[model samples]
Each structure stands twice: as C-alpha cells, then as structure tokens.
Target: MKLLPLARQAEVTNGWLRERLRAVLPEVMRRARVDLWLVVAREYNEDPVLPSLLPAPMMGARRRTMLVFHAPEGGAFEALAIANAGVGLDGFYTPMWDKTMLAEAAEDQWACLRRVVAERNPKRIGVNVSAEIAFADGLSKSEHDALMAALGPELAARCVSAEEVVVGWLSRRLEGEIEAADGINALAHGLIAEAFSPRVVHPGVTTAVEVAWWLRERARSLGLGCWFQPSVSIQRRGEHLGDLGSSPDAVIRRGDLLHCDFGLHYLGLATDTQQNAYVRRLGESGPPAGMVAALAKAKWQQELLAAEMVIGRSGNEVLRAARAAMARAGLEGRIYTHPIGYHGHGAGPMIGRYDNQEGLPGAGELRLQDATLFSFEMFVEHALPEWDGQRIKLATEQCVAFRGGEVHFLGGRQTAWHLI
Candidate 1:
C-alpha cells in the first residue's frame, strides 16, 4: 500500500479537524446544554480530547494551552486559542494571547481567560470532569483550582461537566474520517493475514511469540503502531490454555488451533480484531466438522449482538436484548463490545465486559448514536465432539461502523479460519 507524505497527512488531518469542529462540536454542546466549553492542559499532561482538537503538525499541547469554545444562543461558535501565536491553529481558532500581549499586560493568562468568560457570560460552561468516563475526566486538580480561581465563585457555579459533549464529539466519525479508517482497517486485516500465513510462521519452528512480534514489526514497517501488544495462542484438543499466556517461546505445531488478538493504531483511528487460524496436520485435509460448527456458533452470536444495536437504545438495553435473543436461539456466549476510534477502547457506551457480562452500571447506560464505530467483540463457548466433548472458547472481535441505522463491517469480517 502507498503511504501519504508527512505534509499531505498533516493537511488531511487539519481538514478533518476543521470539519469536525464545524459540524460536531456545536451540536454536541447544544445537546449537552453547554454554552461554552473550556479545554485546558499542560504540555505533556494533555487531555484526551486535545489531540483530536489540535492541528496535525502540533503533536502535543503547548505550555499552558487553553482552548475556549463559545457558542451563543443563535450564532456560529468561536474557537479561541489562549496560547502562542503560530502553533498551526490560525484558520480554526482566533489567537487570544501572545508573548507580546502578555508582556504588555500586568496580568497573566488566567486574567485573559476571565475576560473572555466575563464577556460571554454564558449560562453553562462545560469543563472536563466526570466520574464515569475517563476520557471525559481530563481536568487535573491544579487546573480545576486555577479555573475556579480565575472565574471566581459566582461564575464557577455555572461550570458543568462536559462528559456528554466530549463523548459525542469523540465517538461521531465524519465521512472523511470514516473513509480513512476503512483503509487503516483493511491494512490491519492484510497484516494479520500475512502473519498467519506460511511466510511468517514456519509451523513447528516458529513460536507464538515470534508471530506476535512479527505482527508488531510488520506494523512498524508500515509506519503504524499497535494499541496493545499482539497476542497469539494455541488451543489444543485436551489442553485448556487459560489466560492465553503472552510468552514468546510457545512453539507453533501442526494440528493446533491458533487465535490472535491484535489492533493497529494509525492516522488517529484504532482497530481491534481477533481472528483464528488452523494448521493442517499430516493426514487431515481440513479442520473437523465439529470445530467448524463451533465457529459457526460464534458467528451467529456476532449476528445476534449486531442486530441489537438499535439507533436510540442504551448499551445496557442492547445487552439485555441480545441476551434474550441468544437464549431464544439456544446459544450461550459473552458480549463485551466497545466503541473504537480515537482510542482503542474509544468513547461511547460499553455493551458488556469480560468480567461483568450482566451489564455495566454507568457507562452502559449511554445510548448508541449514529456514525459511531465499535469493536464487535464477543465469544461463544461450546463442546467440540472431536475434542472429546471439551468446550472451547471461540472469541472474535471485528471493527464495525453504525450509520444510517445500519452496521457495516470495516473491511469486512473474518468468517473462515485463516488456514496455515
């Protein structure tokens, strides 16, 4: 695959940021009942939303960077950057502070922030603070104290947590971003295919760890990175491999069933995928029918989960519906799907968890929205007759997007085992 030049990539990223700010930010603020949004962060301790808001070339937050977004009752919002003049936010944000301006004024940046807030006198000012979502809880104690001090007691009273706004902004994917993510997901699938093939795995000679590192190295070679370390594990006939150990020395042998959990992070989007592989034994022409049947159950569970992702339903509600459907179909499985985009385990509602499959308390209450992407992650446990009635866990996670009330698998899902 051809890669974009650094300059071109920056241009694309800036364009996406501009579009998202224009389209998503205002609507989210309005829905969340916020008239003003303040995003402040130090240099290295950047907020999660900062990367999405910043211009592409500017990798991290600058010294004491403060972004103030003001949306009035009926007009277009204003984006103001209270930081240095030339950090590549010229078109998107109006510069509110510079070194020369600071030198002229006896007051500091906080004073300028106060002036901006006092001018607007917004009824509701949104800040990053929440107990439920970590991505929305970016404000540090010191930063919070400084903000309260700058705004004074009365104005600070209007401050509200921006959890809803931040969640909406981060989870909604623009058209261009969705297209870019499609390419990234396709590349990830191709890399996984290569890793499972004979080119990288030499049967008994290669180890699971070797294949895992090969996948990581392959991603690096393509100028990409993995959000989590890639994992490859074996599930033999009688041996129940608990925890799927990450040891790099577990050798790959014939007749062993292989599973991989991998994800790639590139161009501001992340993908989480899990695929299986089967090695051919000396006399066997293909995997046993019972093993194939077990995989079919996993696919069926995926379908059941996808069918429950209605537009306005909460994640917990969806979980209940999916479980009911699975019960009707006589299938037993666990669903732990989550949104994936800016972060690997991205913002929005969490369907279920590996440990807590009943329902997540606060996070699961978040309703599903359109134009959001998710990792359709789940597993099915069933007895395989070929393996002496031993039950196996067949887990699968594929990147999918929900738009126009339809769920589309980004770059398609893996239905058949990747034969080695």
Candidate 2:
C-alpha cells in the first residue's frame, strides 16, 4: 500500500475539490433552496467544514478566510474566496480581496463581503449555523455577530441555517472518491489480516494490548493516520459474553475468540473495520460449531441493515425497519452505524447509537441520500455450546458505499474468521 507523495496528494485532493465544487454545489444549493451560502473561519479557529472546502496543501484557513457560494435557482454558480492574501485558490475560487483589485490596503475583509452580498441581493442567505449537526454549525458567535452587523438588518433577516446544503455537500461522494475509498479500505483490511496472523500474534505469548499497539505501529509504518486508537479484546471460554470482551492485557490463547475495532485514515478518507479471529487449538480444524453459527448470525444482521438502507429513507426509519427484520429472525443485536469519509464518524444520517438502539435524535432524522459512504458497524449475541451455552457477542464492521440505489461493500466483507 504505497501512498502518494505529499505534492501528488495535494494535486489529487485539489482536483477532487474542483470537481465537487463544479458538479455538486449547484445541485445541493438548489435542493436546499439556498441562493447564497457563506462559510467563515479564522486562522486558528477554523470551521469543521472549512478543511473539506480548502485545498489539500492549505492545512488551515488564512487570516479570516471566508468562502462564498452564490448558487441561485436557474442561474450561474459562483465560488468566492475572501482573504487578506492569496491562498493558492486561484482556479477554484474567484478571489474577492485580491490586492491588485484593491484601491487601498485599508479595506476590511468584512466590508468586501458586505459589498458582494449587496450586489447579489440573494433572497435566502445561508450561514453555517445549526442546532442539529455540528459539521453544519461551524460559524463562531463573534463571527455571526460581525456578519450580522456587516450585512445590516434587512440583509441579515434573510439568514438561514445551512444544514441541508452542508450535509448534502459533505456526505455526497463522487465516483472518483468512492473508487479511492475502495483501495483505502483494502489497505486497512490487509493490515488487519497481517496483524491477526501468526507472524504478529503468537498463542499464549501476545497480549491483546500488544496486538493493538502492533496495529497502530503497523499503520504508522505504512504512513497511514489513525483517527482513533486501535482496540483488541479477548473472549475466552468462561467469560461473560456481553462484557465487551476481556481487558487490553488479556493474553492470546488457543480456542479463544479475538476481536478488534480498528480504523485508518488515508487520502482524505477514513476506513473503519471490526473483525474477528480464532486461535486454532491443537488437533482442531476450525472454530466450534456454535461459534461458527454465531458468526453466521452476525453476517445475517449486516445483511438486514443493508436491506433497509434505501435511498431517501431517514436513518431512524432504516434503523426501525432493520430492527424489525432482526426481531423476526430472532437474533439479538445492537447497531450503531454511521457515515464515514473525511471524518471517521463522518457527516450524514446516523442510523443508531449503541446505547439508544431505538434511534438517534437530530442526525437520525436526516435521510440517507445516494452517493454516500457508511460503516456497517454492529454486534450480535449467540450462545456457544462448547463453552457450556455461554452467550458471546460477535461484532463485525466493514466499509460500504451506497450509490445508484445500491449498497457496495468497499472491500468484500469478512464472512470467515482469520484463523491464527
């Protein structure tokens, strides 16, 4: 899994950003009924959505950078960048505060923003302020007040929360991006396979913590970033099934079931995967029949969830439908799936929370749109006859993309355990 050099990575990201702005912005604005959208961020305190909008090389916002998107219904779309100096965004955004165009250096950036809005006179002015999604609520209190003062009363009256456009723009994935995610997910899967093998884990010698750190170090060795710490847990024969597996220091042993929750960040996309491994005891060919059956049930739960991920269905609606199906199958499970991309728990509809299986509140109410990526994360419990009918939770997670009204697993899912 070779990564592109920093310069090449920047080129690829900038290209993707350009395509997104040109192809997705206008339609998203129209769908949200927003004629104008403003994204404001300062140098250190930048908006969550700002990095996604920025070029790859530009790590953070310059001194008080503001992005303006003017996309009216049945009209031309304009992307404007208001900053004190050039931020290498010439082709992507039309510069609003270019030094050459200025009559004097004393002009304020906010004043330029006011002038731009006055000329456009858009009916609906969308701002990055929301009570629901944090990704859409990027505008700071001071910035909001200053914007209101700059726009004055009448223009400020048209201000509205840009949740719809923000979510739509952030969640939507292009064909190129989806393709990249497929490869990124494969890299993560490969790393997990290597870590679960005898080369890294030795029965009775390697502790769960050792394997977890190995995963983290392996990712860094491959030049990959991890959004969260890698976790490894053990489920031995006499342990409680629902105890979230054994502690981090639990040692690997023959006939023990191993589980890991790992994620890697690469190419501006994140891949989250939870997989299971079984240590083969002497003279045993594979896992016990009961353990195998439990794994099968876990796969079935994944299918049930996938079946309900229909286009335009709200996250809560999907969760309800999937749970009903699971109940009909008589399987006990919990699902806490989420959209994944730039951020690990990326911006989009949140299906269910582990603690609250019924549904989430604000994010769950959002509908699942096409061209989005999600992590199929969940667990199912089943009794193992080999362990005297002790119930064990078999958790599995894999990256998937929903496009063209269909669900495509980024890399093929784990149907069988990685035997160590």
Once fitted onto the true fold, the runs of candidate 1 whose alpha carbons sit more than 4 angstroms away are 100-106, 245-248
lDDT of 2 by residue, 322-377 (tens): 99999999999898999998899989999898899888889999999999999999
Clashing pairs in 1: none
- Candidate 2 has its poorest 10 consecutive residues by lDDT at 239-248
lDDT of 2 at 205: 90
Over 1-420, each residue of candidate 1 has an lDDT whose tens digit, in order, gives 677877888888888899988888898888888999999999989998898898878888877889999877797798898886676677889878755524554457899899888998999999999999898899999999999999999899999999998999999999888888888888889888999999998887998888999998988888888999999888878665545535347678888888898999877889999888888888887888887998899899988988999998999999999999999999888899999998999999999988887889778999999999999998888887887887778888899988888888898778888888
Clashes of each: 0, 0
Cα deviation at 199, candidate 2, in Å, is 1.1
Model 2: pairs clashing at backbone N, Cα or C within 3 Å:
none
lDDT of 1 at 64: 80
TM-score of 1: 0.97
Model 2, position 41, has a per-residue lDDT of 90
